[model samples]
Target: MQVTIDKNSGYCFGVEFAIQMAEDELAHGGMLYCLGDIVHNRMEVERLNQKGLRVIDREQLELLHDCKVLIRAHGEPPETYALALRNNLELIDASCPVVLKLQNRVKHAFDLSQRQDGQIVIYGQPGHAEVAGLAGQTGNRALIVMTEADLDQVDFARPVTLFSQTTKSTAGFYKMKALMEARIAAAGGTLDSFDANDSICRQVSNREPQLAIFAAQHDVVLFVSGRKSSNGKALFSVVNAVNPRSYFIENEGELQDEWFAGAATVGICGATSTPLWLMRQVAEGVESMGELV
Candidate 1:
């Protein structure tokens, strides 16, 4: 059997930058606190944690004082910064530039909307760290639309400016935008009153077709990803749809020997938040499962 790792797999630019920052900070002799998992992958988090990266939440952040904290790539709401200021906690901001730009755009749009009765609409999972950060730009007034059920909460009659989380599916965002436009048009609303930005990151959007191709070329796919990764879920669906033999796993330990049955070729890949080293580990695990025929 042959085992290969997808060249396009592993951490994105934002995640790479964040992990680097954490490593650089950890290299220094001092206590370091990260607001959340440095990356969504559990193995990466554990690796960092082994080097003294303390994970803390908002509530815990408030109780701490005069500490140095690193914000993960997911970005944080404005309240996090404010609390850090009040608590005298120095921040190591590692928010992705794409996300930072989207946040600014959302905030600007929200500010402009406040002049009228307009509302800011975001296409993202509710309560997701990135989505929460984007919603915070609208002072928590941005309507989060994750499904058809949430779409009803948006006011089609009023002016709306739509934005999406950096990692959301491009097709999904397009559908959301089209649905909003249809709703407004059906209600006799003018198109000029509504605006939506294509905020989904191209790096992720481009990976969909590439991942589908990778999945199809293999007999079985081991897609490594953290359970908490939104991009992981989105990309995995693409692969699974293309190749039902695809399997998702967090680590090499999750690999079952039975999965390799009758498979002459196996592919190993992962989400943007996944580390390359973890993919290598998974490949090694597959190698140990049996002899290549």
Candidate 2:
């Protein structure tokens, strides 16, 4: 049996930077309060928690004062900064540059939309951290849509500007765009009044094709990613589409021996938030199964 890990599977630059910042802060021998999970993976979060990282919710953040808080890669809304000021809290901002730029763009779009009576629409999970941050830029006026049903909230007759979450699948974004275009036409609105931006991160979009190729090359594919990771769900769909033998697991412990039955080659891959070490661990587990095969 052969076990291989995809070279393309691991943390994106933004996630890597945030984790590095957290580790650097933790190295100074103090408790670092993170606004949320530094990354979606529980194993990695637990590992960091052992190093004095404490994940806190928004309610908890409001109650704390005059302490250092680390902003995860997902970023935060303007109100979080306002609250920090009120509480005299020091924020170690580790927001991804991509997300920050998107927020700026959304804010600018929102201002323009207000003048034309337009709507700001986002293709993302409604309550996701990144979506919340993006919505904050528009003063929470942006319409969040995950499926055709969510599009019901959108006024197709009005001028609409659409932006996608950075971690969302490229196909999903384009699908939403198409749906919006169809709706606009049905409403007798010209496409000129519609603006759709494919704002997904290049690092993430590029991975789809790479992952498709990787998945096809393996006999059995094990996709390791945290269940809550948006990128994980998107990428796993791609892998599973290419290779029906694909299995999504958070860790090696979830691996089943039945999955390895008659599998000569096994491929291990993960989402952008996934750590390479976790993939390596999964690879070792596959190798152990190889002996039994």
Candidate 3:
């Protein structure tokens, strides 16, 4: 059996930066509190937790004071900063530059929308950390839509400005844009009154075509990612579509010997948030399975 790992797979720059920041802080021999899971991958989180990184939620953050808290790649809303100030907590912000820029754009657009009596709409997973951060930019007034049914909340008669979560699939964002355009027409509104921005990060969108090619090249593909990762789901969809033999797993332990039956070549790939070491471990597992098969 021939096993290979996709060179394009693994942590995007934003996630790599955040994890590095966490590790650098931990190296100083001090207790560090993280606002959430440093990354979507549970194995990576567990590894950091062993290094004295404590993951806390919003409620926990509210109750703590006079300590250092590390914000993950997913940026926090204005409210979080306000709360941190009130509690005298030192914030070690590691927010992704892309997310920060999106937040700024959303805030600016929201201000403009107010003058025209327009609504801010977000194409994102409802209640997601990054979505919450983006919604916070609009003062929690942005209508979050994932499916066609979620569009019911929008007022089609009014002017609408739409933005997508930075990590969302490119196809999904365009579909949402088309849906909004149709809704505007149905409400007797012109396209000029609606604005849709494809805010998905280039790092993610660019990977789809590359990953599709990678998936097709292998007889069997192992997609490693945390099930909770948004981009993991998005990218895996592309892989599964290209190669029906693809299997999504979080770690090496999830590998099945039966999956390699008669397979001459195997490929390993993962999401932007996936760690490289994890992919290497998966590759090793696949190689070991070759002997058994």
> What C-alpha lDDT do the candidate models reach, one value each?
0.90, 0.95, 0.94
| Alpha-carbon runs more than 4 Å astray in model 2 | none
Clashes of each: 1, 0, 0
lDDT of 3 by residue, 20-58 (tens): 999999999889999989999999999999999999999
Candidate 2 lDDT tens digits, 203-261: 99999999999999988999999999999999999999999999999999999988878
Cα lDDT of model 1 by residue, 1-293, tens digit: 79999999999999999989988998986999998778888899999999989998777888999989999888988999999889999998999999998898999999999998999999998889999999998889999997867879988889989888889888788988888888899878998999989899998999999999999999999999999999999999999999999999999999887788899999999999999999999999999888533
RMSD per prediction, one decimal? 1.3, 0.7, 0.8
* Every model's TM-score: 0.97, 0.99, 0.99
- True-vs-predicted CA distance for residue 41, candidate 2, Å: 0.5
Cα error, residue 205 of model 2, in Å, equals 0.2
Candidate 1 has which clashing residue pairs, if any? 1-293
Which ten contiguous residues of candidate 3 have the minimum total lDDT?
Answer: 284-293
Model 1 scores a C-alpha lDDT of 0.90
Q: Rank the candidates by lDDT, best first.
A: 2, 3, 1
Higher-lDDT candidate of 1 and 3? 3
